[model samples]
Target: MKKITIQEIAKLSGVSVSTVSRVINNSPSVSAAKRKKIQAIIDEHNYTPSVFARGMVNKQTKNIGVILPDISNPYFISLITQIQKFALDYMFSTILFNTMLAEPNNKNSKHPLTEEDYLKIILEKQVDGLLILGGEIDKEVVSKDYINALNQLNREIPVVVIGSKIPELNCLFIERNLKKGITTLVSHLTALDHKNIGFIGGEAGVKITSYRLESFKAAMASYNHSVNEDWIVLSDYYTADGYAAMTKLLENNTTLPTALVAINDNVAIGAIRAINDAKLSCPEDIAIVSCDQFMNGDYQTPRLTSMDQHNEYLGKMALLQLISAINGQVEPMIINHNPELIIRESCGSKL
Candidate 1:
């Protein structure tokens, strides 16, 4: 009762070991007829290639490790869905790691998993490539430890960051044009005569928050308007955070902003609820706009107006880039995707 090996499978199928390996890896290089014959032999022998053996032979496990900050967020969910889909199409398996414990405000965080921690785990697993979505990589000022860990990981396998940039690191980045997206959202609000516009959601010091905040200021200044510091509320990227921020704005400020720009749809939705609790009307008392356009936005009370970051497209592109880099077909590069503005009822746009 000895186990059948790939060598035996190849001999029985009348094909080379490399061809058998290609068939096992689901490579498209094998012809349909040959693939069928090889697969028939494999099935007859009930041959199952050992992952370790295959890795030793080809130096690849055909596994990609994906790390993201929050799985609850629809934006990240969409990205993961698309990434998994694309990986399946290429016959690669995905290992997902949710780094919720690594977020900024975890006071009781025992094992604060950083990019380095995940990289170590993924590397230990011997994944072909690594896809990082958020956490320390999204920070405006990345720590030395994180950067050093990332550098070490890059030397081993292809690393791709989605919607984040790590300076001085030779990692590939797939990001949306945050500045353009924020400016577009602000300009749209200004065009509708929104002068006193406030921002909600996203913590201070985060790269994404700074990018949108700075872009919002620049966009306001372009229209000869000034950003009132009192109206700006920085909070975590969550619905509850948005609600609390909006409530604080209403409670503390003498005069509320005519419109508000939320970091994402979750914040926008929560802000809308806050306004409702205060018996205030959206677009009448205050208009609202969001950066990330998710499916939930369409069914919201007012239907959120948002900048579509194209999460699915970004995910697909990141996987493609990672695969290419893994295959040595492309060098490390940055791909910036343009965000599209989806004008809906929340922004008070007639069109």
Candidate 2:
């Protein structure tokens, strides 16, 4: 019933504590015979190395801190799963912090955990690196105080940003190419002779919404089509918001656009519900496409045509880049991921 320690394994294996440490750390310096003997004793005793003990010798806690906005969203959930998977493979543990206290329409609202709060915790925990996703980084303008806090944190520990960019702070960024993905979505609609394309969902001041809306405009312009400002509705990134935005658009506009582009699958699904509730058929009356793809999109009345951002790959790459930065092998830089357009029934391609 007692927990066996590495020291006990070393003594039982007839090896020094240093040899046991080397074996536990997977160092090649330990001879094969000694490794076999030590490993057998370790397995027999069910010994596990204390992260604290290893940190004392190597000056590394072998732990990573991850901060993201909301884990309930499928996009963030998938991304975090991949990140945690990669970190575990490399013998690193991840600590997650969900800062979900974002206020509606206000970018500068103080959340439950301030930047200083995160900094203090990270320092106290002595994590080797930090992975930041969403929150203030998703804002069009990051506060100077938050930037200063991140700068100080980066000085003490390596930091990487996933799916957002903070230019003022010296941090590595891994993001999908917003313009190209939106362009692809528009091109698909234009190819189907959809001239009047509308956009739905996304708050006004958020950085991602701004980037995506700009990309939508550029993509539309490329086809010599001017965007209808009336069709462009601004709302939060949720299904109910999308439904309300669509309903408002229907109420205000005498002529509806032939096609609508939702910011993401959640928005697209809600828009589809609103269209059906209005006694209009999807794809037949208004073709719909989404910027992001997830599992639920497939089972809808009409399958959603969406741009796949390869979130899992993004998560894995972010962790790998962070490890490289922690090892002093790479400089802080921006990494862009290209999204793929998936054609399906929602856009009327199959119909």
Candidate 3:
């Protein structure tokens, strides 16, 4: 099939090519009547502009490349959905690159991804902007090499970091206040007469995990209850890992804590299963509190008491901020959102 061109549109509309060009480019010189006639012809033919041509005029490829550490996690999954929705509304396209950062691959492999891999993707894909999620965003302890690589990327393109932060980068930052969320959980437990509260946290390596762990300690300390190292189990954010961590904490000799604060709803659900396996009832033998406030948490046998981080809202805000940065309308600023606690039957409070 022959491609539709401005010449064809101008001929069909009974106008000059210059008139069609003015209409297409939204130039002020084009009369409304002529612009409508050209646009109607173009619309009837369903003429799609080539990205290359658009780039020549706008200096943008209209593509936002998203690099996420792990795409499978529910949190990230929800984030992606919201981001895609906003991108579509703005008439922008997105390309995804999943690093699968937590998949336990050999770190000593020959093809380890350096900063160059990221830079190459931007150049090769011709993306106008970039959104970096997860691993790099949640780097609590970043190496000098990691910092240098990120700095290189920042100098080149419009970048945004979602649900995390990086130091000294001119990139928009959006973060859910995990510490406040954890504190809400602790307060719930404290209200339930839970003095001996145990915590199940994420692995020690990542920045988000470390921040949550430290927050948990601080919140617990505020209530005059020190977290027992034996009671605190650190595991990767997986259901099986969460179950195993709960198992380990139970296997210890000390008495089980009256309540458990899980890192996220995923971990808390696993802990719930572990609790049931041990023949103890939730909120009767022990109460369960988690984060993320996933929709499914409400449908559980006993609804979960969790923290709602408003992830979808966060995703929308991040996309809006990214667009602002991409258009050079605003300098990158940190967006710190606080989480709210949703009380349910799992914590045994009717209120």
Overall lDDT per candidate, in order of appearance: 0.87, 0.86, 0.77
Ranking by lDDT: 1, 2, 3
lDDT string, candidate 1, 1-351, tens digits: 688888888888888999999999889999999999999988887888777677667677889999988899888899899999999897689999888766354548786665567778888988899998887888888888888888899899998888665568878888668899888988888899888899888988888899888888899999888889999999978899989999999999989899999999989988999999999999789999998888778898899999888887888889999999898865655566889999999989999
* Pairs clashing within candidate 1: none
- Residue 31, candidate 1: Cα error in Å is 9.6
lDDT of 1 at 257: 95
> Which residue runs does candidate 3 get wrong by more than 4 Å?
1-52, 101-104, 107-116, 334-336
State the TM-score for model 2.
Answer: 0.86
Name the candidate that leads on lDDT: 1
lDDT tens per residue, model 2, 1-351? 899987788789888999999998799999899999999988888888887788778778889999988888878888899899999898899999776754442366664556557667877888999998788777887788878888889888998887666668887887768888899999999999999999999988888899999999999999999899999999988889889989999999999999999999899989989999999989999999999887677888899999998887788889999988887866755565878898889899954
Q: Flag regions of model 1 displaced more than 4 Å.
A: 1-56, 103-115, 333-336
Pick by TM-score: 1 or 2, better one: 2
In candidate 1, position 145 carries an lDDT of 86
